[model samples]
Target: MSNRGAGGLLGRRPPEEETGLPKDEIFDLMSNHRRRYTIHHCKQADGPVSLSDLAEQVAAWEKDKSISELGSAERKTVYTSLQQTHLPRLERAGIVTYENGEVELTNQTERLDIYLDIVPENSIPWGVYYLGLSFLSCLVVVGLWMDVLPTGAVPTLVYPTIIIAAFTVSAAYHALANRRYRFENLDEPL
Candidate 1:
């Protein structure tokens, strides 16, 4: 075989072609706090969201206040930003459709979830947690291999079995935690 291209033997294709948007542009779109809030609100919305209403929600979140308590200045700043800049950018990216003073997420928006991993505040990053787990597992295996730690009547089989069980349980918990961050479950707190 002379070649093994990204899209099979046919040939390599750009990520933009495959995912409908380039990874760089996707990252660029997510770079702004307001844009991120817009996407999050749109995902939680049942259907098309009015620009003014969306701006209110975003302003409230940004100010850490209830919608009813939002000042006109806070709402106006977010509303103008969304109307003039954020929505048009998102519309061009095909992640959302903006029309008739309303906004709705498009199919292309689904492709973005992979980039939008929402790690809650004060929580350990999953990568760091998994790395620590793997390291601890290795130490256990090494300890047994060198006889530095005693099993104390526990069978040799039980050591690796415990390790496997730990991994299995951790993986299951990780999966469930991830699902909670998804858009469909936005009704729950992050």
Candidate 2:
């Protein structure tokens, strides 16, 4: 017999190819709170979970009340959020399959490993980076206006230019610091 090795038939290919789920789709699937929780619960569950059961669990966790006790208003809100926002996205991602009244984790053993690795606990905030850049830019502009440095020694614009260069260096450092941890969905491999 040819040695297929440890993965058997399932682990033969890299995890990405085996799942047929794209990296972006997987990231989107796990980004949200409810969907993430649902996947986590399903992973631990013994078998397929019905929609009602899943809803009941979510409702209890979110509202601290039974699904039945939720009034029409609350029910409408939850139903809309689930049907419109959560289920469609999860279904499309191939992480969860919806059938009849139940949703089941499809090919759980094959996909779980990929899902865990792709979805990280934290992400670099692009907003923070841009904001810092803006703040530094502003500081440099003010320094130039104030004539804080010796004139003719360096052009007025040169001060800001040096600051800009420093900012670029720091930004590059930040990007590199978090580069390994970046989600594959957000950035292409360098």
Candidate 3:
């Protein structure tokens, strides 16, 4: 049998539809710094967050100051931008619901997290660290094979075994840490 159409014996259905907004739209929604900040705050919020509070927090971040120290000018500027520009854009993208001076994340919010990986400043990227580890491991293996270093002092497999084990453990720890991010456990202590 060569038939593989919809009515054919295989009867394969269409591909499963994506659950939320399209990826392009999600990226567009996250393209702005203010909108991204709003989503981050909403994710940590216990419930619907007042727009005023959200604006204050965003302003503090922009000014590198504490919320208590945020001037009225800074707060008002951020508040106006959010209300007149960013919030409406986010609302249109279905990523958040804004109403009555309060904003809440919708189901589309979960999609944002996958795109918003916030690495702290002055931190080494994990890929570079892993690559360095791998290079060192390979160098050690080559040295052991060529007897360039002490050949009889230690077992040949020990170096590779330790490197592999370290990589595995590090991967597991990173996964656990990502899964236990602040937004996922607002009620739990870090």
- Every candidate's lDDT: 0.85, 0.64, 0.76
lDDT assessment of candidate 1: 0.85
Runs off by more than 4 Å, candidate 3 = 1-27, 64-74, 147-151, 172-190
Q: lDDT ranking from best to worst?
A: 1, 3, 2
Across 121-174, the per-residue lDDT of candidate 1 in tens digits comes to: 799988899899899999999999999877778788888898899889989999
TM-score, cand. 3 vs. native = 0.67
In the range 1-190, model 3's lDDT, one tens digit per residue, is 6658764346743221232466577667667778878887888888999999999988987888889998899999999999999999988877789999999999866645656654545867778978887888888888887988574777777777888898998789777666755343432211
Q: Which residue pairs show backbone clashes in model 3?
A: none
Question: Model 1, which residues run further than 4 Å from truth?
Answer: 1-4, 8-15, 146-152, 183-190
Better of 1 and 2 by TM-score: 1
Lowest summed-lDDT stretch of 10 residues in model 3? 181-190
True lDDT of residue 19, candidate 1: 62
User: Cα lDDT for residue 117, model 3?
Assistant: 56
* Model 2, backbone clash pairs (residues 3+ apart or across chains), number: 0
Best lDDT goes to which candidate?
A: 1
As for lDDT, the candidate ahead, 1 or 2, is 1
Provide the lDDT at 162 for model 3. 86
| Residues 1-190 of candidate 2: C-alpha lDDT, one tens digit per residue | 6546565564476455667665676666667767865665566568898776776656555676766786666655655677677877778767788778677787743465545534335754657867877887787677667876576777677776777787788778766755444432232211
